[model samples]
Target: MSEALLIAVLALPAVGAAAAFFPDRAGRLFGTVLAALAFVASLLLGAYSQPASWFAYTPAAQGAPPIVPWTSVDTPWVPALDLRLHFGVDGVSYPLVVLTTLLTLLCCLYTLWHVPTGGRGSTLVALLLVVEVGMLGTFLALDLVLFFVFFEVVLLPMYAVIAGWGGERRRHAARKFALYTLFGSVLLLVGVFTVVAAAGTADLVTLTSGSVSLTRNTQLAAFALLAIAFAVKSPLWPLHTWLPDAHTQAPTVGSVLLAGVLLKMGTYGLIRVAVGVAPEGARWASPLLGALAVAAILVGCLVCLAQTELKRLIAYSSVGHMGFVLLGVATLTATGIQAALIGNVAHGIITGLLFFLAGAVKDRFHTGDLAVLGGLRERSPWLSGLLAFAAIASLGLPGLAGFWGEAFAVVAAFERGGAGWVTLGVLAAIGGALTAAYFLRMLRKVTHGAASPAVAAPPLPALRVSGMELVAWSPLVVLALLVGLVPAVVLGLSAAPVQSLVEAVTP
Candidate 1:
């Protein structure tokens, strides 16, 4: 039964996390095997599993529909107010659950040989496995309290990775990252409690099935708390200050996963929790959200043009890319919503690759400073080629995975069923142009240049790209090409769900 799959999907990495603490070299091998199995399982789930099986999870409530959670697993640890151990998965969660599993496995595989953690490779691998549990649970939990528990569970491990295993400023970055996310977590907790207190059920499925009404004031207030929490996680615009520092400081695998998968949690929360549960509030706030998105895109693009540090430039690019996701949500249309979804996946893969190459560049030449690091193309052609490909992809080059998300987002913005959305579309188009310009400039400086004297002069042999590194990275690159060359794969999955969401939100 699919229920069994769910248990394995979550439990497998967890089991690995535990085994990974065995304090031996086999810890890495054990973790790799477990992670690989989970990744394969996730692929099976996404490619072949039926939605009927996925929605086996049904939330319990008095006003709910007749269908029950056919295969839920719960344990009663508290009965005073009806909170207990609860776990489930549903249609809305299908893609994310699979993504979390797939990427975590890749991260585990990547860390096995290429990690830069402070002589604590096994411990770092264990932490990532633990982080996987929190990620999977966050996407699948039906109960509000359970969701929050999983949501907050990821904080400490990530903090340790950034602070304990990070670069020179790791500790400072860790502190700042913890403080920012914790601030958002507080707001999210308040919002979750408000929902439970008012609606009397922490069950998301039940809330989705029926209608719940609250006054405008309460809706707005609760919306702020929930949206801010998601936004901080998404690291949208002003609250986005934490991400660049975190990315700049974390190791390559950490940066790849952080940029690729972790940030999607925030946007996923925006759609799954904020808009899905708080439609009225979402409608009220659409205009303002649109404006902030536009500002982020513009600001993110402008800042990228000024960056001499390669990683920081891409870090800022995340700010711009997420602006598109917010813009899609602000529109509240099927097309716009789908654009956001596709954009989320695209950015994760493309930017994740970018970080990978950035780290590789650092590892090769000993600096990500664009100034000192000239002629990587000559010194290391393979690294140069990979960086170029990812750079083009990140800038939304046509016929690649990045193009569709930005292109349609602009189209949706123009026809986003409102004047506000139209404005966002225009601003985003400008951001797109800026994206192209900055990336072209970046390519010139890093990947396509005359070698410095050292690079041009003889005796220094070019750095070699390893086989395992290729295995670790090529999947994302291939996907970026697949989605770009054949966007239908992504579009087909998102179209129906987005249609449902847009119909619900449209006035």
Candidate 2:
């Protein structure tokens, strides 16, 4: 109800990270205390938000109320460039802020005993809280420069996690991750500057309300720069080469955030920036974006099929899932945008769950190679069952989170047509089949056989799956069912934003 929520949301973790630096094992205790309070505050904010504008596609009463009053905080920061430090959220930002906080807190829980016992554990937890602050700020920022600053803040901690605490090729993977992302950030800065210079203001609320259009040539160029930046984060094909290595090297909590909230930043930016500000450019670039989307789906699926490593396979599959989100955006319709929006949330939860479980399995077995791990069902029925369930959901099994986004995107594609859209849709459908093939194969290989030697973990007093693990996984499983059964839980709140975006971009 007040800006205090925003300040507290960002500050709680910073306080925890600072407190963790004490000479004792206070990092874990500080993280727990602060994480719990931050999560609770976020929840209270969600429950206390005001009502939003209505969308006819959804019943008026169904959407989530604003997570706080639709309040904007602004003060002169870089007055030389007419930039102000501004931040606010409407319906769109509400859910994602809650998501970032929710997952950060959950990731904190998962790390309590789950982090690598001896090596850089405190630093990992502290960095994670910093990552949370960055994600929260990115979603809530109302100024382009502010958004960019917060967005970049996320890079350091993530790079450190992968490079410092990752697997065998941590340095190489971290360097590649930094290079690819830094390039994108450069382009993103160029685009942000272009918008500020051309439009005379960088406040998102004002920019959305202002009907200023860049020249078609300018629009196309700027959109290309901006879109590519987002795509790299989205890890859309070609630009996605760095993701597998990064994911493979990252710790479990790192992978969860990467697959979950971090990747969504790109797709979110494309809709919020490119289409929202440069509708003409979006229309002109539709065919190109569509082609890239379908291509990414096919290429990602193929990679998934060929991967022998479990984490690498899951990372590739994200490339495929995100392709579906991009494909939806290319259609430039309410349904398409809605599909992208809701699908992003679904993919985040389900895939985040998979990575979390994958890390658990790897900890138990000391490996993530499919050929080495097997019959997890026999060894740990609970873990095996959850893995199978997540795999099914990933493959778009009905009555689950995965089905809504893919199905809706396919429908959106079917409903729209222009410049080879038909072909794009056809290829995407085939990609969908490939998705099924890879996930099914993964299930067969990892959970179906007798417990293999690779699955044998260190003989440290049989690590019982603790109550805390249940506390972490139970929400994911319930959320999978909740969203699967009642997707309106998300789709409803997102409808207004989706419609607003489509109307802005439509011819």
Best by lDDT: 2
Residue 371 C-alpha lDDT in model 2? 89
Q: lDDT per prediction? A: 0.78, 0.81
> What is the TM-score of candidate 1?
0.92
lDDT of 1 by residue, 1-507 (tens): 666676787888888886546664678778878888887776665544454333233223433332133345566646887887666553446666766776777777777667685756777778888888888888777677888888898899899888867889988888999999999999999999887777787776665444656566766777888999999999998899999899999988778778888888899888877776677788999888889988999999999999999899999999999998898888777667777887888898888889888887777666788776677687778888988899889889898989887888788778865676676788899999999999988888886677865445444443787777788789888988988987666666555445555555555
Q: Which segments of candidate 2 are over 4 A away from where they belong?
A: 51-69, 456-464
* Residue pairs with backbone overlap in model 1: 400-484
Q: What is the lDDT of residue 311 in candidate 1?
A: 91
Tens-digit lDDT string for candidate 2 (114-173): 666436566777888888888888887888889899889889889988877788888899
